[model samples]
Target: MNDIDDFAQAYVLHRRPFRETSALVALWVENLGLVRAVIKGVAGQSKSAILRNAWLQPFQLIRVQIRGTRDLKTIYKFEPVPTGVVIKGEPLFACTYINELLLFTLNKHEPELHFFSYYQEFLKRITDIFRPDTEIEPALRQKQMIIELRCFEQYLLEAIGYSFDWGSARDENIEVNMAYGFEPGEGFFPQASGLYQGALLIAIAQGQWQTKGALGAARAALRQQLEWVLGRSLHAPSSQGKLMRPENG
Candidate 1:
């Protein structure tokens, strides 16, 4: 059993007020997966209160020391990661959507270092999209953002053992330009009335995003796959309007 006295690198996924002077936080730690902890005295007028207030926001990377024996641990310290990425606009809502997914998908106490790294890289890519030095056109930028979200969703599903093969194992001569239907628990099958284009399925299987309509195809495919894993529709109410708006319009 890992001791609660040690400090771990983590990112805040979500937080809410627990009582009058404390708050409950969900943290995605480097080696400990998602943890729910109680931050004591954060709402009080103590000297460390201001620091806690600044460091406890969602998506801020921090090093924390927690102590407790029960399911809910008590945070002892907060050390913010310098040079942490700051997100705004549509990316901010996208971040929230991913956070909600993590909260719902991850099991407490299971260490998923690969998924943790995938999350870090995902944030880095989102930050890069908004960088002043980058010169992406507005339409392409929106498409790239959607691609990033879909890629992360795929990674998340695979990490938790819910991944389905994107290619048909029985068909070795499958054409990359034909239409195919995706059956849950089975791979893609060639069909004249299939909903997904062969080029799109191939692109998703290979993680290629340079082709036209790749992003839109990935969005539809991932949405269906994620819905199957979640057993319900994946709804991001806060960003539904913005997400549904056409990128090229």
Candidate 2:
């Protein structure tokens, strides 16, 4: 690829210590899809002086300029976006999930600005709900996480160009309430018994979170679909499973 000078807004997805005093950063860039670049001598550098402010944190928007290398690029400058300082904790984690998915699945240099915007909006919503001093109501937290995850999943599938039959998959008027299965190409389907509720599928596809119960059911179902498609080699972050696990309390 020719050297291109471009200013891209990106979300830091993952970063690893690079060759002697550098870091290899994976980013989901606006209009550029995913790009992996190396930030030279980022560690031990003052956050006030460099791109350290956005290092390894998810849900942060940054303007990045990079010079392409064979494996990774020389990231010239990464400045935190105007909206960067406000996100933290659970909102951060939710963005991390989005980052992780892009890091593992998206092809580099592909443009996906719309999906990136939706991902950003999802994180923005969660950040707005978070109150550090107050104990998070379990019911509310659960509802929020489920809604956000559903949105993420839908965006992912759509970004990858998968267009499943949402109408048939979520047809509530059907007489048979039987257990259904999802193929990689075909969405939910009634083979023997469509036990999967059509309404839940519709709710998830529509991004509707009207009821906690409906959201919870959609969460469980969508999780299964994403996992199966991602396959065993693509492991979810260890923290992601914890966020989804049921609490005894």
Candidate 3:
């Protein structure tokens, strides 16, 4: 176990009060996958007022100085990276959902720069959607956000090595017109009750979300795949689950 004293970019995934004057924080670092650290004296009167501020909020990009060994680190410095992005209402719930996914999916001390970049892009897209100058109808905006969430979920799976190929399945080419069932830890196979459409799978593979019913299809497919990969169903409590539900959106 080596001590790391360098600064790195990170986003707060979750935080909870520890003792009386400190907090335990889960941070997603650029080169470090997921890091758990204790921020000393943030909850009480201390000089590290920056840690007590909104900069520690989830999805707020920031640079942090981490110290100590692999099991648990201590955050000595926290600085905000402002993007002027504000997430509220349904979008906020969507953010929470993604954060939960990361908390469950990522492991400690692993480096995943690609996943980090995708996460940054996801936040930027959210910021763009809610920008004051952009004109988008409520219904349309909601649809777009859902698609965005699906896209992010797909990328997250890929990053963690749970990706599925849409063009080919188990070393065989997928017929564009055929319906197939998805087998976890294996590729697709033809089945009468298969829930995935070839064209829809292709669209998801190609990152195309504008097609009719594509959003719903992507959501269902990804959720099924993720549950299989994680070995448990995603339990998003009724409230957060409703935000990501296509029918509710």
Top-scoring candidate (lDDT): 3
> lDDT per model, in order?
0.72, 0.60, 0.74
CA-only RMSD, every prediction: 3.6, 4.4, 3.3
**Model 3: residues >4 Å from true position, as ranges?**
45-51, 108-111, 236-249
TM-score of 2: 0.75
Clashes per model (N, Cα, C within 3 A): 0, 6, 0
Q: Model 1, range 23-141, lDDT digits (tens) per residue?
A: 99888888777788998777877778767888788777888987877788888887888755878876877777787667656542242467887787888888888776778876567
Cα TM-score of candidate 3: 0.86
- lDDT tens per residue, model 2, 1-249: 334577778887777776656777777777766777877766656764255734445666888787865756677877777663456654555555555666656642233558777777777666656655446675577556656666676667667665455446444432234455555555666656544565655554565678435565555555555555555333433423423222211
Which pairs of residues clash in candidate 1, taking residues 3 or more apart in a chain or in different chains?
A: none
lDDT of predicted model 2: 0.60
* Cα lDDT of model 3 by residue, 27-106, tens digit: 88887678889987666556565455567888888888888876778888878888776777668877777777777677
Q: Which of candidates 1 and 3 reaches a greater TM-score?
A: 3
